[model samples]
Structure formats: C-alpha cells, structure tokens
Target: MYSNLDRPPLNVTELRRGLDPFFSQLDVVAETGSTNADLLARAADAEADRSVLVAEFQTSGRGRHQRTWVSPAQAQVALSVLVRLPGIAPADLGWLPLLTGVAVADAVRSVAKVPAELKWPNDVLVEGRKLCGILAEVGTTGKNPTVVVGIGLNVSLTEDELPVPEATSLVLAGAEVSDRTTLVRSLLRDFASRFTAWESAGWATSELADVYRERCATIGAQVRAELPGGDRIEGTATDVDANGRLIIDGRAVSAGDVTHLRPLE
Candidate 1:
C-alpha cells in the first residue's frame, strides 16, 4: 500500500519498512488535508482495517473538545489509524483513547529517553508540559464499529510555532528532535504491539493497568475537573478504571477537563 510515494520526502519510509513484519497494510501521505479526515472518508467506502494515515502537515487538524490543532509544515507528526472492532460494546469505546494515551507514553519514553505521564483521559505530558494530544473517534457504520485513533505530537516545533503557551516540544524538553519519520515509525510500532496485547487480554490485565498507572500524572493528586454542565468537582485523583474512566475520590469520571491542583515536585 505504498501508493503515496510521489508526494515528498520523509524519513518514515525506513520506519514503515521495519514495521512491515507487524502490520499487513500501511499508508503514508506526504501532505494531507488531515489524516483523520482521510481515514474517516475511506472508512465510509472500505473496511480500512488496520490501515494507517500519516500526514506531514494537516491543514485542518482537530483535538479533544473540538479545538483546532496547529502545526507548521513538517514540524509535527499527525497520524491516524483505522481499526474495526467486532463484538465490542459501545460502552467500552471510552477505553480506546486511554489505551492510545498509554501507547503514546510508551512510545515517547522509548524514543525520547524521558519519562512521560498521562494527564487524565488522553494527553501526554513531559515535565508538566503537553507533549502529545490524542483524539479517538468511534462510530457504527452499517453495524460495524469503526474506531479512528488520531495522535498529534509536537516533535520539532519552535516556540513561535506552538499554538498555546503551555505546549512544549521534544527539542525544548532537552530531547533531540530527530527526523519526524523515525519518531512516527517508532510510535506506530510501539502502539501496534501494545494494542495487540490490550485486545487480547482486555484493559483490566495487570500489565496494562500497571503501566498506565505508573505513567499517569494525576493519580493520588488533588485536581479540579471542569464539566460541561459548569460544575466543578474537586477531589484527590484516585485511579483510572478499567474502562478508562478517571476515578476521582470515589466517583468514576467518564468525561471532563481536568486540571491538576498542585504542582509536582
């Protein structure tokens, strides 16, 4: 499925070639309108099982809360993967983003040589600054559940290119910002390996739970979750449930915007 080779140059070709042993199908786009958009459109026509879309630049990228994600051309990794989950209940869909966040934390740790942590539902943080953003979208099309996991990572962006004040890149965090292709390749490989395990044992397996909790930045800390209903719940972050819900005090928070109350030492 190496059809988009004519676009531009990327170092991810080597990474894709290495990943050939794991995935049966792969697709890389030099520049796309948006990887998520392209995959969603294709999912409407084809099964798109285990297919990946990697874009060098996205003209219109989106994140959680439907916020726009900004990136300079070739300055970040915008990737999406389409998978078909059969017999999975709609209620279990929330775990996909959490699974993705863990996968990303694993990948970044492997390549960046730094410890990464998960901020609630689907954000990756390094040194209390955002390093990655994950958005998982699920829909039932013709009785089959299609899940698109989109990941946007700040790889080599300069300070001026950052869209927000709190964003940080690998280079800024004292990690070398190598070729975007290599980083994306490593991410997909790590994610595929973890995803296979998660699918086999489910999210409750000790291995998955331990890893997520170890990398989580919110557990055992006081935090405030901003709910859509304009209600704020303040409590000590307890744990993350098997279904990827954030456990605050005794309540299972399925969705909200969380802000850690105290700084980590």
Candidate 2:
C-alpha cells in the first residue's frame, strides 16, 4: 500500500502565491467527481481561459471512452483546465489532445528529470509504461464553447497501488523530483505558452506538430488501433497529421485506441 504520509494536501494559498502571476484562476478542491466535469458545467460563468480546477480526490474520474481512473488519494495529480478556443473550427479541435500531451511530456521531463514520451493522441509514458492519461472534451450544449483538458498523473503511488499492470508513477519511474505542485505549475506555464502561440496562428500552422512528433513514441512503432464498431487496424504508425490524426499505413485514423505491439522476430 502507498501511504501518503509524506505528501501534504495541496495548499491553495501556496499555489496561488506561486501561480497567480501567470494564471487568473487556480482552484483546488478536497474532493470532486471530476475536474473536467466540474469545469465544463461551470464554463459559462468562468472568468477566463486557462482557469484550472484540481481535485485531491475524484469519486468518478473518467478518461477517453469513459474508462474510470481511480487513483489513491493524494498520491496523484488530477487536474483540468478550461481553455476557450472560440471561433476555432471544430475540425481542428482534435489537436487539443496532442497539444496537451506535448505540454505534459515537456513539463514532466523538465521537473521530474525523467524522459517522458507521448503515446499518440494522449497517453504520457515513461519507459514505455503509462505515467499519465489525458482527456479532452468540448462543451457542445451550453453557451460556453470551451475545451476542458484533463490530466491524471501518477506521482507517488507504489507498485501495489497501481490500478493496472501497465501503469507507472513518477516515484516508480525513478523521477529525480516528484513534487506535484511544482509539476502542475510547470505544466500550466508550458501549456499556456504553447497554446498562446498556437491560438495566435489561428490554428493554421504546424508549429506544434514538429515538437509533438519528436516527443511521440508511436510514430515509428508497429501498432494496433482498435477502432470503434469492433474493427481494428494493424500497421506502422508513420506520422500524425496537422489535424492530429494518426497516419497508419496511409490511413488517417481520427479516433481509436492505439496499442503498441512487439516487432516480429
């Protein structure tokens, strides 16, 4: 069992003290169902873009395809940011996952001193084991047309505490530093800058593609993409296009869960 004895609860006062200069809103709750769900529901009244919502515990946190993500209390970082990308075409919104993935990989590597690679579209991995999962959702019904990007990072969980066999944590990955506050703050800063540049270009450039490609582990791997409707595609992942779709065997797969497969002997 992973004891959170050494991990202190996140102090909003301390977070605001360090993050206020760059962020307009930084909130942390003792517990919640999901930060993304909370922020999505509150987006209409949100003060501005980049407003962050973090929860120490989630009763029903979810990932892509509605998979539940339950982490040990205080042993991980569950956070979501409300980014308002008004007027950006819905078609280009697919980039949100890749965008956030790049930010996470960069920030984690910088702070934790552990090499992190992005598994196309979202998952963040360290040494081929998942260290983080990202979920991006766009509000389609309300007047607030904002994107909620949620990240769940395993920080201090022990091997016994891991929810799945393929998952990892910063502590398990041998991170030189494993402070959640510092890592979250750094991620916000990196995401903000990357988003600023991408937004200013009116979603018309590949300014982020090059960097995402460099950090993506799926680009040159043999993979299996399990598509919706019980169909699957197996091929070499060649690249991710400007719209963030995985190009496998000359097919642009916009939505699917890709599994990396071992190369044949």
Candidate 3:
C-alpha cells in the first residue's frame, strides 16, 4: 500500500456526490496500471459512456507516443474520462485532444493560479515546464466510437519526485492549492462543460480552435517536429488549422513530436 502523509487519498464519496450527475459514473481507485487502459476496457460496455476514473497512483501510466508516465503515489491527479460519440465523424476526432488541452489549461489556470499554456498536441506547460500530459485513445463499441482521454497532472510532487527534469508539479509551480480532489473535480467539470458544448454544436471547431490557438504557446514559436519514420521538419509554428493539425511554416502536420526551438544568441 502506498502512503504519504503530505498527500492524502481522494474523497470518493464527495466526488461522486458532486460529479455523479454530470458523468455516467465516477470512480476512484487506490492504484491501477493505467486509468486509460482500464477505461478503454470498460468502453466495451454500453454504459461506459461519460465514465470518469481517477486513480491515486498509476503503475504503468502512459503518455503520447508510448512514453511512460510515472509519479509518486498520491502526488498527482491521474484521471481518464470515457465518452462515446456516435454522431461525430472520424476525421474530426483529432480535435478531442486539443479540446481536452484547452479545458486542462483553463482548469489549471483557474485552480492553480498559474499561467498554463498548451504545447502543441496537448501537453500543458507552466512557465515552459510541463505540468500535465494528456493522451486520447479511440475505441469502438458496436457501431458507435469511444474516446478515452487520460490526463496526468502533477499536484504535490517535489522537484526530486518529478519523473523528468522538464516537468513541474502544482506545488513546485507555486499553485494556490495543490489538493488533488479539487484539481480533479475542476478538471472533469471543465472538460465536461466544454465537451458538452462542442458536441451540442455538432462538434464544431470554430470556437474550440480559436480558444486553443489563443492558449497555445507553440503558435508563432520556432519548432522542430520530429515526425514518424525518422523524418523531421523545423520551422515556425504558425497556427492550428481547422482540422487541429499544427501549421508549421505553412505545412499542416497531423502527427509528430514537437520541440520548441530556442532562439539563437
């Protein structure tokens, strides 16, 4: 059993009482391999729609590009939310992660009082240090499609506890509050509200795209996109197109690992 005096367990009862009506189901576990994996398996069930799973610790948490995400027990908010979208087109699904990034940045900004910005493709950064990582996976149940969006936010982790030198926790970033429960609740509520609005508008990209661009720090920054198959593109990040692809030097890139290039002296 993982125990930390500074980091207490989440209050599942309070979470359910406050968030149950908004989500199909709300659950919190002491430890799990990955909330995304667990929710993806549950997505096979029809009732898994809008399910929310928050784990106090994720043994094998994963980030984008098959990267491992690890944090000390009770030191972060490891959450995954499952939503089924039967009416949305497959081509437009790329916006899901971008939308999630917007919600996460907004939540962190509101609760943590930190200036959180989006690195292209959904990594949340505070003062150029990563504070959260988001991963969105797609699945199918019957004819409808399911999306499990996982978010791992650093909460109370000290500098030594960080998995990477470039990562920052809320406490380390001087957040006004680093309570995991509050942060998780705020993140879910914001995501649900934004997602519900977008879905109601037939998954439109106009509003979401505008908001994402404004909050994205990568836009207009010099970047080097390391694409799959060992190809790379280095140029300025101009904008995020209607399809949510990063526009690099007028080229729209759909998939790649992007690095912000520092200016020369």
- TM-score list, all predictions: 0.89, 0.94, 0.97
- Stretches of candidate 1 off by over 4 Å are 1-9, 141-143, 202-207, 263-265
Best by lDDT: 3
lDDT of each: 0.78, 0.87, 0.90
Q: Give the runs in model 2 whose Cα sits over 4 Å from its true position.
A: 1-3, 20-22, 46-48, 140-144
Tens-digit per-residue lDDT, 98-172, candidate 3: 999999999999988989999998999998999999999997834478999999999888889899899999999
Rank the models by TM-score, top first.
3, 2, 1
**In model 3, what are the clashing residue pairs, if there are any?**
none
Give the alpha carbon lDDT tens digit for every residue of 131-245 in model 1. Answer: 8999888744444678888999987777887889788888777775455666777788888887788678743345776777888999988999998788889999999877677
Worst 10 residues of 1 by lDDT: 1-10
Off by over 4 Å in 3: 141-143
What is the lDDT, from 0 to 100, of the residue 101 in candidate 2? 90
Candidate 1 local lDDT, residue 123: 92
State which candidate has the highest TM-score: 3
Model 3, total clashes? 0
For candidate 2, which ten residues in a row score worst on lDDT? 138-147
Model 3 error, position 178 (Å): 0.5
Tens digits of per-residue lDDT for model 2 on 94-197?
Answer: 78878899999999999999999999888999988999999998865233368889999999989998989999999999999888888887888888888888
